[model samples]
Target: MRFSQILRFHLSNNKWTAKQQYVPKHNPVLEEDIKRLQDFLMSKSNIVVLTGAGISTESGIPDYRSEGVGLYARTNHKPIQHMEFVRFANVRQRYWARNFVGWPSFSATEPNHTHHAVARFEREGRIQSVVTQNVDRLHTKAGSKNVIELHGSGYVVKCLSCEYRIDRHEFQDILNSLNPEFRDAPDMIRPDGDVEIPADYVANFRIPPCPECNGHLKPEIVFFGDNVPKSRVEQIAKMIYNSDGLLVLGSSLLVFSGYRMVLQTKDLNLPVAIVNIGETRADHLADLKLSAKCGDVLPKLFNFKK
Candidate 1:
């Protein structure tokens, strides 16, 4: 695919789906396949690892599309829409209620073996950079120096109408002060740090406005019905252009934001390797596809201590 074709494809498929199911299955991988993955990394000088929610699942965060234990598999909960979050007061109230209830546990999650091994890969100069769809910031927490958060970070809260910015922790404190009596425990934390709480518990929940401008506040993330910023896309494109290959870690590439990076690599005739638990959208396009957990396989490849 050419640049024009890539752009067209992105435009066509950028819409969000309510639910996508993948069988919770891991295929047997041979020793020779492991060797092939090692050789694949050895053959590339500049490699970019594109990661997704699967990488953080081991850290105890649930992704939306992973097989049985994923959020969609266990619940019929729908993600908050970009427009609704921006336009509706009630939606923002419910969202903040869930976030407030779930933030403590979600923020406490630590980086797992996969994150540490990827950081090791960067330290050893085997990989040049990481482009992750995960907003959890685990890659950076694991000591990866050059990381691009393709979908943005949930740890940041920005004013929708102005230049006010606040750390999520600070915002959490504000939420605590405002809703002192709204103590509700979440059933479970979703991938986006949201949880399921009673509707009545959310009715009186208060969400603060931007202190600097009284503007609407939202997390700095690309929501389900939103597009990734054009500048961010161009930045990743430049990284891929300078790289020898793309190594997808833990991502199924169901979302085009990450999948398009694989497509762009393919268009450049670069080798693409996938290390994931199950099937991926780009399995047919990969030079080698390893159906294994990232935490399990990455430690073996990098010889990192768990």
Candidate 2:
């Protein structure tokens, strides 16, 4: 079927229900398909790998719209809008309060097999670079060098007013001092280091200001309704143009920023491969599609020790 003939690529409600009951039943891939991807990678020089949250799910981080397992499936709440976060003090407070509590556990998360596999590939000179949509920085932790963080990282705090940046781990100490009696009321953690704490719990929550100018502090990550910087986009496009092939791992390409890479590669007539459990926006454009968990499948495909 043509790209135009494909259905709009998002998870369906019936599929969500089935996933909840059965859990993680990815479509079985043909042996020839794996061989095709392996051969494709071996033939390419300066291969570019793009990744999304599915690569980090095995590391204990929940994805946003991943059928039954995602945060959107579990909750009716919408993600905090960029305008709301910048404009409203109360919104930021609620966000910070929940995020600060969630940060401890979320930060403790380590790189899984999926991350290691990518890193191993890079080390073996099979891949030139990786571009990730995730804020978790697991790719870096797994020892993948030359990674372009498409959405930036959540590990740093940025002052919206003064342009001051500080490590998120350091900012956590400040948060602890501000809300000593405040503990996380909800056990559920969201994809963006936020939790579902009670409204009452957030009412008196304190969001610390920037030390230099007493400005608002936000996680350095790009929020929904926010635009990725033009410079970053240009840089990523150049990298994609320079690459011989594009390999997408564990991303549905639901967001345009990550999806654009595949589109660019297609436009350039470069070979494209996508490894995702669910339907991706660029599925029709890919030369190969592997519907499997990145952690398990990637290790099987690319063993660095060999």
Candidate 3:
């Protein structure tokens, strides 16, 4: 079913849901959790924060591995691998098609309470910097000062064969122009700005080339199985070394890239705090672990955003 002129697809009932809007619920245990987290924060300064999918789940973006409501749990769709995305024409075509459909809703997502809390904490001189595995770019939007996009952001598209780059907004317009018939089609949006289109209709999806040299254009995010850029890795390593401790928020730490951050902190004998609802790879190593909703716990613990 369509919503006005725009095509809308909802995953739950395989019907249509409302236009995207998100507001976090208040937690009953927030007060006690805040006090505990505050006490934990008191012992650390100049800390490094590592965040993941769990952080954005409250912002209406689904995560990949949450037990009841994650992408991996519900579907067989795998995130595109870097090599496949680069090597195959059909892969790029499909990716861009899904991205084009999902962009409006995904990019329209707002910063949630935990995002603002982290920004406030940074402003108040609590943490040194943020290193995130997410490609959403919501941290900077929430007013975080020092942020390292460990996996890059989905806001820019770059050519694989050239340095030609363009804002995703510009690319959206380009996509609409090239594929007018599909500019608004039935789309089921996902967390990473990819949508679910019918398998048969995908054959007709159009993909635009880089205006400069007709090179392949891909989002700036480091796709799974891709190595993080050397410079980005080096920078994060420096940030980790210059920190007082490590604070992990809303990550399952299943990915080695994110899990390694805490391991380095452990090697340095620094205190590590993990705030997540689910079990993490580093649970045994955490100096403090709080299983709570990030949106509910963070705003209460750090209200400097106002």
Candidate 4:
């Protein structure tokens, strides 16, 4: 089936029922607010968009912090703090194992309407740049030309000891050699990919060493407690600085890395618009809030002339 047909089917069949169910209730935006957002975008020669997991949820990826479906809530796991992963070998192994299993699902997800809308905005010259908290790379897949990944992507694995970088596929081979029994593990496995192997069995699991320097390997994403790379932060800041306004999609901005952009935009006195299903940490900071599904609202709001 064509992609459009698949989207229509999913929308009609209620594949995203959970998301719809959790949609927050907020006062409907007045027509004046809509006009303000529209005028802001129209007036700007350069607009910057900061997006979160909400944008990808329509594509079947779950947001990490959305009520009962959040990663920590659903997995019955605590958030992995950065210090723990860096200091503890077992923690690192567990992290990689979970990722190994979850990688396929994350990798398989495609761009949805919101992503396409952002791409359209860029193509139409309404948007000059995008900064995304999602590591899923949906924006790039949707043909966005310039995107800053605030949290690094899961598509690449880097060795800590030797500083070696390898494609996720190559890392999968290493995982296979170490845990052959888990090579075809079921999808029900943990979100990070580690199977429910007994603690005794875990001892025998041989995490592969870096091909270059025999060092530890880690996913490129910034885990809880890890700081965003300064250079990456600066790049996004510069993008925001140059743009006339900022648009936030699908994020609550609970994390400072995500929230700080709103503060920066406000500091620069730029108009800010947000499209989210729930109350975001930056809600008070926005000039306009569209309390609607990104999939439903973005396509309409950013309809570009082709």
- All models: lDDT? 0.82, 0.80, 0.79, 0.75
The deviation in Å at residue 297 for candidate 3 is 1.1
Per-residue lDDT tens digits for candidate 1, residues 1-306, read 554355335434741211112224566566677788888988876999999888887776778876676778777867889999988999898888887887876687678888999999999999999999999989989999999999999999999999888899999999989987854353333333345566777897888888888889999989989999999999999999999999998888999899999999999999999988878999999988899877657887744675
Highest lDDT among the candidates is held by which one?
1
lDDT tens string, model 4, 238-302? 88888788899889898899899989999999988898877889888888887766766666664
Position 85, candidate 1: lDDT: 93
lDDT of 4 at 91: 85
TM-score, one value per model: 0.88, 0.87, 0.88, 0.84
Model 2's C-alpha root-mean-square deviation from the true structure amounts to 9.2
In the range 150-206, model 2's lDDT, one tens digit per residue, is 998989999989979999999998888888776433244433333667787789888
- Which parts of model 3 are misplaced by more than 4 Å? 1-32, 186-194, 302-306
**What's the residue-level lDDT of 163 in candidate 4?**
64
What ranking of all candidate models by lDDT puts the best one first? 1, 2, 3, 4
How much is 219 displaced in model 3, in angstroms? 0.5
Candidate 1 vs candidate 4: which has greater TM-score? Answer: 1
The 10 consecutive residues of candidate 3 with the worst lDDT sum are 15-24
- Model 1 alpha-carbon drift over 4 Å, by segment: 1-24, 27-29, 184-194
Candidate 4 Cα lDDT to native: 0.75
Clashes of 1: 0
